[model samples]
Target: MKPRLAPYLFVTPAMTLLLAFGVLPILVALLVSLTDMNLGGLADYSRVSFVGADNYRELFGDAAFWQALGNTGVFAVLGVPAVIVVSLVIALLLDRGDSRLFRALRAFYFVPAITGIVAVSLVWGYLYNTQFGLFNHLLSLVGVAPVQWLGDPVLVKFSVALVAVWRGTGLNVIIFLAALQGIPREYREAAAIDGASELRTTVSIVVPLLRFAIFFVAITTIIAWLQFFDEPFVLTKGGPLGASTSISLFLYQKGFSASQFGYASAGTVVLFAIIAVVTLVQLRARRIDAED
Candidate 1:
């Protein structure tokens, strides 16, 4: 085999799978979105009518979809920064020590990311319980009235976002820690020789060097929060007036609960477009930064 053809040959199987599963479904969904396909239509193709852009038009006018989109935007806004900061801080702290205890703590922090979502939700539900939850109990000790963590419409967004932040940070913490370790000892030693404080060294030297890792985390974190679903789905089910309904959950409810597959497909296409645009902008910014 020619050396020039080796890389493409190796990638061909994976590319084929991506095209088959990813591209094919997207094209199929685009086609379906143009029709009024439903449960009844599924059984009888003759009953399905070609609606063209009607679903898109209806989706644009949907209050529920707009609400879901707003909620998704809020989730991403709250989650992306919190995850990046929290994970980076934890990683920085953890990287300072090279003991067995620190190693174990690193693994401990990551447990939430790998744990079952249902179990996490069940535990958080108990914690968020109005009457007998742990959080209210703690608040009571401080002479504060019990606040509705999940019941209040305004507060529920933060409550749900907090859970997502906790769950999401573990993996990013690991990523940041790996990046921290990859920095050479000489860099820090040289900074110390120049009389730079630990804080100054971190702020000026460590952080700037981790730009690529931070960028990677930021991009993935943004995508994850944009598609936020698990915690809301399991904990609140988009809850008390759809306060926590993310775009993904909204699509799921529309497609499965209401069996509005065509409409849901239209929403899915919109989501794909949003993600693509956001990602493209990020990539362009990164490229510009690299050039500068």
Candidate 2:
């Protein structure tokens, strides 16, 4: 076989799938965003009208859109850092544990990540229950009032963010654990010889070495939180007056509940832009830090 032909043959299947599933849907969505398409249009091709930027323009004035956007921003900002820091800390502890027991514990920490979101939500929902929940039960033992977990708007934001933290930290734990294990022991030993304390060694050696893994986890966490849906949708359904409503859930409401496909598609494009800008900003910051 010719060298060039073999290379193409190896990539042909993956490239074909990438274009078919990834690029194709994006192109179709972009086209749909320009038109005023809905359920009526689904039945008749002629019903879909080219509204141009009307849907996008309308979004700027939509109160729900802005609220949902704010909720999503809060989740991403708060949850992403919490996940990264907690996971890294746990990974560091587990890395030091280095025994059969710790190995088993590592597997235990990962259970939440593998569990279905609905199952996690149901369990947490019951825990957050006012009458029979374990959390309030514990608070009662401490002589504290049963604070509304999902009822009050302030509590609802934190209530859902807590569940997100629980579900998300597991995967990052695994990633950071692996990265921790991969770091050369000689680097730490050299640091020790140079009179570096444990904290100094961690700050100077371990963290810099784990930069790539940290960056990867940070980016993925931000993207995931920006699209956070299942937790808020299942737990509160973006409820108690849209307190925990996220961009993804709002998009779901627009596309499926209201059958406003074009409007939802326009929201999708805006969301895409938001994610792109945020990711780019992080990349720029990372680059600047690297330069410094």
Candidate 3:
């Protein structure tokens, strides 16, 4: 092969895979969203009539869809910041401590991230059980009434969000800890010499330096929270009047349960557009931060 074409040849395999698995599926889904293509319609191509923007219109007018979107927004809005702060605190603590026991404790905290979501959900479900759960048992000790966790529509979103935060926070903690460890000790020492307190140094120096890692965690957490499915599906199944239903779970139910492939495709496309826009915004923010 010519030297000029060697670089292209090296990248050809990855490009081919991207087109086949990524680009092609997105294009197909876009086309499918323009038609009435259910399972039956897939079997009989003649029934797959073009519907233009009808599917998108139907999704827009869907109350359940809107509810799911709202729930997802609540999940992201509440869960993202909570997770980021909690993870950063843990990371900072782990970075400061220098004992073997602390290192072991850090590993214990990260165990949940490696655990399967379904397994964690199942465990959490038992813990959230109204009658015999650990949480209610603890509440009983405080003389507080046992709240219906998954049963109440108002509490269901919060319940699921808590479970998601618990399960997902560990990974963010690990990410932030790695970033904290990467910061030089000299900066902290210099700040201390200048009469800066630990809190002030952390706020003014450590945080600003970790902006890239923070931005990365925020963007990834947003994307992951948008696609939240396993916790809600396993725990509530979007139950208690659909309070915990997420956009991804809604897509799954519509596509598989209702067999509305085209409508699901439209939802998926919308989700893709939302994620793409958010990612671009994060990238621009990162660029501006770097320039500063």
Candidate 4:
């Protein structure tokens, strides 16, 4: 083979695997979405009629779907920024300190990130228990009434978002810490000499320098929040009148529970489009900032 052909040959296996596993499934799902396919229809070829965009239309008109989308949007809007800020602050503290205790603390903070979501959610579920939770116990000590953390519809989404932030912040902290450490010492010293206080230097110098990392963390967190599932699924099961039902959970219910494969495929496609658009927007914004 020629040199160019050799490179293609080397990548052929991986490309073939991707096509077989990824591309083929997506194409099949798209086709299925255009049809009135169901589990029964799979066995009977004549029953699987092409329904065009009827599945898409039904998904768009679904009140449950709209509610789920709104809930997901709210979760992402609140959770993503909260996680980024908390993580950045933790990262800054960890990056600045030299004590062995601080190093140990970093590991402690990161423990949650590595823990399985199911296990963590189970632990949090106990902590959010209406009568016996640690949270209620703490509130009792302060003469405050116990609040329903996950039971009430209004508070359910916020509670899930809080758990998501707690679970997610650790990884972003590590990422931000690594980014912070990569900054040269001279920049801080120079800023100090110019009468810049720690806060001012952090906001003006450090943050600007860490923009790329911040942008990266923000985009990832947004994507993660958009697919918010495990916490709500385990803790509340999208409960309290489906107020915490995320788009992912909705898709799961449609695809698995209700067996509406065609509608589920349409929802999945919409989700992919939304994520793609949002990610592209973030990338463009980052590019603009870089140019400025």
Candidate 5:
């Protein structure tokens, strides 16, 4: 085969799979978003109707949808910084030594990320148990009242965000650690020789060098948080009165539980648009930085 044809031939299978699984599903969803597809329509073709922008219009006035969007925004706002700062600090500490113990510590931190979120949520549920949780017990010892972890609307967001941060920290830490290792030792040594404190050297040299990696993590993380469902679904079931219902969970409830597939599809499309725009902006920012 010619070189050009060879490249196409090599990519043919993957491209076909992508079209079949990824692109096709998105196109189908877009179509669904334009229709009044629901359980009744699913059961009888006669009930199906082309609703055009009706679903999208309804979404604009949906209180639950707005609440879900706000909850997702709150989650991203709290989670992104917590995950980045904790992971970067741990990565910095781990970068200090290459001993076996330190290696084990790194592996230990990564364990949560590899474990199933359902399992993690279940374990955390037990930890958040009001009557007999470890956290409550600790508070009892200090004469402090047992705080509601997942029960109250006011506090549930923070509780859920804590789990999100803990779950996300491992992966971010590993990425930051890899980026830390890629920086040359000489830069840090030179800073030290110039009487720069560890904190100053880290803030100026290490963080600046890791900017690209940080950007990657931030963008991907924001996307994930936007679609966050599993933790809240498994932990709070989007309650104490829908306090933890993320956009994904809201979509699932509308599409599956309430039989409003078209409405859900419109929400999904809007979410996809947001992710695409944010990702493109990040890519453009990275390109500009590269040019500089």
Candidate 6:
């Protein structure tokens, strides 16, 4: 192969997989959304019929769909900031030392990220239990009444978001740590020579250098939160009146539970549009920042 074409040849497998799995599925879902396909349609092709924009119209008017979208928005709003801040802070603290203890702590913090969602959900389920849970027990010691972590509609959003944040921060912490380590020690030394306080040095010197890493983490975190499902599915099952139902969970319930595949596909297309628009905006903003 010519040198000019070698890179494309090397990437052919990945591009093929992306087209087959990623691009094809979106196209398929878009087509499906335009139909009135259901379980019966799956069994009998003749039963399926194109419904045009009817499903989209109904979806826009759905209270449950709106609620799920709102829940997902709240999840992303709460999770993205908390995840970025907590992980960055932990990474900063961990990076301050190169001791074996610090290294061990880095791995320790990452445990949640690699852990199976089912296991995390099971443990947190016990913790969120109203009566005999550890959180309620802790509150009792402080003369507080038992709090229903996952029961109250208003509280359930925060409770579920908190679990997601905790689970999410682990990987981000590792990312930030790697970025921090890549920063030159000379920058900090120069800041010190300039009589800069530790906080000032970190704010002025360290953080600006990690902007790219922060932006990367932010993008991934936003996408993950938009597709929020695992915790709610395994822990709450979008329970207590669907308070914790994310868009993904809503789609799951509609597609699998109610066998409304066409409706679910419409929702999926809407979600894809939302994510694409948000990400493109972020990329544009980042490009603007880079230019300046």
Candidate 5 stretches with Cα past 4 Å from truth are 43-46
Q: Candidate 6's residue-wise lDDT over 160-236, tens digit each?
A: 99999999999999999989989999999999999999999999999999999999999999999999999899988
**Model 3, which residues run further than 4 Å from truth?**
1-4
* Cα lDDT tens digits for candidate 5, 1-292: 6887998999999999999998898898899999999999888878889999999999989999999999999998988888888988999999999999999999999998999987998799989999999999999999999888899997899999999888899999999999998999999999999999999999999999999889988888888888898889899989988889999999999999999999999999998988899889989988999899
Candidate 1 lDDT tens digits, 16-106: 9999999999999999999999989899999999999999999999999999999999999998999999999999999999899999999
List of clashing residue pairs for candidate 4: none
Give the number of the best model, judged by lDDT. Answer: 6
Clashing pairs in 6: none
* CA displacement after TM-score superposition, residue 99 of candidate 6 (Å): 1.0
Q: Model 4: per-residue lDDT, tens digit, 1-292?
A: 6887998999999999999997898788788889877777878878888999999999999999999999999999889889999999999988878799889989989999999988998888888998999999999999999989998998888888998899998889999989998999899999999999999999999999998999999999999988888988888888989999999999999888888888898888888889989999999998998898
lDDT of candidate model 1 versus the reference = 0.95
Q: Give the Cα lDDT of each candidate.
A: 0.95, 0.93, 0.92, 0.90, 0.92, 0.95
Model 3: lDDT of residue 292: 81
TM-score of each: 0.98, 0.95, 0.94, 0.93, 0.95, 0.98
Better of 1 and 5 by TM-score: 1
Candidate 6 runs further than 4 Å off: none
Clashing pairs in 1: none
The per-prediction CA RMSD against the true structure, in angstroms, equals: 1.0, 1.5, 1.6, 1.9, 1.6, 0.9
Clashing pairs in 5: none
